[model samples]
Target: MTGRKVIGLREAVAAHVRPGATVYLGNFGAQLFAVGHEIIRQRRTGLHLVIGSGGILLDQLLGAGVLASATFGHCWSPVGPGPTWNFRRAAESGERPVTLYELSLGLLTAALTAGAWDVPFMPVPGLPGTGYTDENWPNGRTSRVDSVFGAADVVAAIVPDVAFVHVDQADADGNGVIPGPLGETLVAAQAARAVVLVAEEVVDTGTARRAGIAVPGLLTSAVVHRPGAVAPDGAIGRYERDVAAYERYVARAATPDGFADWLAGHVTGGRDA
Candidate 1:
C-alpha cells in the first residue's frame, strides 16, 4: 500500500475530471454527494453521469446544468420516496435538454459487467414488453443476440472516464473498505478508465488490510481523504442519512428560480480547502 497518493478533494476532481467526461459516482445508497457538489462548485460541465441509483445527488448535478446526459436506474429521494423536481423539470420542460437513459437495476448491472469484462455486451433476461426492448428507446444501448438457447436481450458496455467511489476507510495506497452490500460499485470501479477512492477516514496500510479492501489499490488512480464524503446519503457504520435535508431540498428546489437560489446559497462560490 506504499506510494499511494492522497490528495484533497478539489485537486482530485480538478486533476482527473474533465468537461464531457463519462463519470460514475458510486454506491447505490451511499452516494457521493460531496463530490457532486464539488463538481458543481468547480463549474465543471457537459458530463455524462452513470449512477446506479440516481438519488438527489444526481438531481443536484442536473439542476446545476453540469451534466449533458445521464444513465441511471432511477432518480428520486429514497426518504419520502419523493420526486426529484429538477429531474422532473428537465424531463417535462426540456429546458436544460439532458439526454436520459433509464434502465432497470438488473440491466444496469449487466451493462457494467460487460464493461468490466471488456465485452461488447452482456446478455440479460428479456424485459418482455418494456421499452428496453424497443430498438430506439435507449438509443442503441440494447440489442438482441441469438444463441443456441434462444434470443436474449443484451446491454452495451458502459465504461466511465473516471469513477469516484466513497469508502468507509482507505489507505494512501488506494485500498478501500466498503462496508455493506456493494451493489454495482465494485464492477463500476473495474469498468472505469480511472478510479478515485474518497474515504471517510485515511488509515495506514495495516488498518486498511485488516478492514478488508473491497477495491484494490492497483485499480485506484488516487485516494482522497474526505470525512463525511457522502453526507446526506450516509456511510455504513459512520453516519445516518439526513432525511430532513433531503426533504428540505425537495421543498426548496421545486422550481428553476428556486433551485438557482438554493444552489447559490449552498454550493456557488464555495471554497474547497
Candidate 2:
C-alpha cells in the first residue's frame, strides 16, 4: 500500500481546518470524538460548525469555546430528550454566545444534497409557511425562486471547508466502508472541499473495495487509523454507545465548574481517559 492518503489526526486537522472556517461533522453512525478532541487540543477558534444533528460531540466543541456559530437540525444528547447543556446555555444565557441557525432534518439534507450536486440552491416543498422558515430563514443564503414547475422555497448550498467523519473501516487509499447507517456522512463528504476520515481499522484496498465503498477515495483528503474513535458513542457493529459515559457527562456538564473539571480530566488531560 502506498499509504499516501493516510495521515495522523493532528496533521489532518491542522492542514485541512483553519480558524473561523465552516466545518461539517458527520454525526449519527459516523460521529467522531477523536477529531473533536484534536480540534479542541489545537485550540481552534471561531469555527462555524454544521451538523445534521448536534449531539455530545457538538457539545464538546461548544463548551470548549471553539464555535462562533452553528447550523444544525437538532442539538440534543443521545441519551434523552433534554437539550445539550452547553448549547442551551450558549443560546439562552449567551454564555459562550454562539449564533444559531436551526433547520429541519429535511432542509439540512436538502442543503447538503444541493452542495454535493454543486447547485446554487435546492427547492424544498411543504416549507413555505412554517414558523422556522419565517423566523430564522437564511436571508442571503436562500431566496424564493420561480421555476418551470412553480415558485418554491429553497435553501442555499452548504459547501463546508472540511468534513470530518469516523467510519468502520478504510484502506490506505482512503476508500471507506460504513457497515451501518450512512446518515449524512456520505453527502457531507461529497460536499466539503476536503474530507478527513477516521477509521477503526485500515485494511487493504481490495478488502475496502469488496466491502463496498460508501466514501470514495477521491473525495477523501486523508484517512487516520483510530480504533474506538467514536467512543462514548457507538460505531454500530464495532461497539455499543457508552450510555453510562454520556449520562455521567450530562450530569457533570450541567454546571460550569463541573464541565471544566470534566474537560480537564477527559479532554484537556488525556483523550483516552
Candidate 3:
C-alpha cells in the first residue's frame, strides 16, 4: 500500500487526490475516459481542472459546486454546448466558482511537452515580437515562443500534481496506451510528478513493452485497474452516448436551482449533496 500498486477505481479516487491539486484528464468521450465524475463525487478534494477540450463531464464539474478552478484548451462538446452557461455566469458574476485559465488547446499541449522534456519551454509556432517574440500581444503576458506558439505561459499550462487517464491498454508495469484521445496527454503525464492510469485491460508487460505506450517508462507512479471505466461522452467506440440522459440533464442545467437539481439527480447520480 506504499509504492505504486494497482487499485480499484474508487480507491484510486479517494487516495491520491489532495485538496489543492491540479489534474489533467485525457478523453474525448465516455468510453475511453476515467470515471472522473465519480472521482469528484467520492472525495472533497479541491481541484484545478486542466482539460484539453470540454465535454459533458466538464459541465458536471461546474454544476457539482466542488470545482475550485479550471483551465482548458476549448469548450466544444458533442453533447451539451460545452459549459457556456456555467462559464458565462461564473465569468460575469465573478463568483470564482471556477477560475478560468485561457489558452488555446494547441498552445497548452506544447507547453506540457516542454515542461515534460525539462526544457525552459517548448518552441512552438505563433506569436512574435517583445517577450516570446511579442510582436504586440494584447496586454502582454507572454513568456516564450516557437513556430506553433504565441503568448505562451508555461506557468498556466503545467500540471502540478497528476494526470488521470483512462487508457485502452496497459502493461502490468504501468505503461499506458491511450489510442483514442492522446491529446498530448503523454506530455501531461510525463511532466507531472505522478500519473494515475485506469486501463481498460492489463496486458503482459513484456509483450506490449515497446508498442503504443505513450508515457515513458519512468514517469508513471501508479496504475489503477478499472477495466471498463470511462467518462460520460468522453470517447467513441469504448462507449456510446446515452442521448436521453443528456437531454434531461440539459433542461436541469438551464438555471442555478435547476442546475443544482440536475447535478443531484444526473451528474451525482442522486448521491448526497
Write candidate 2's Cα lDDT for 64-175 as tens digits: 9999988887778868655578877877874548887777777777888899999988888655577566766443455688879889878888999999887788999889
RMSD, one per candidate, in order: 2.3, 2.1, 5.1
TM-scores, in order shown? 0.93, 0.92, 0.77
Best by TM-score: 1
The candidate scoring highest on lDDT is: 1
Q: Best to worst by TM-score, what's the order?
A: 1, 2, 3
Backbone clashes, each candidate: 0, 0, 24
Q: Tens digit of lDDT per residue, candidate 3, span 152-252? A: 43332374477787676676677777666576677778778777777767777654465577754466667777655653443445655556655666656
Candidate 1 Cα errors over 4 Å, as ranges? 1-3, 94-96, 134-139, 147-150, 271-273
Clashing pairs in 2: none
Looking at candidate 1, what is the lDDT of residue 180? 81
For model 2 the local lDDT of residue 235 reads 78
What lDDT, from 0 to 1, does candidate 2 have?
A: 0.82
- TM-score for candidate 3, please give it: 0.77
Ranking 1 against 3 by TM-score, winner: 1
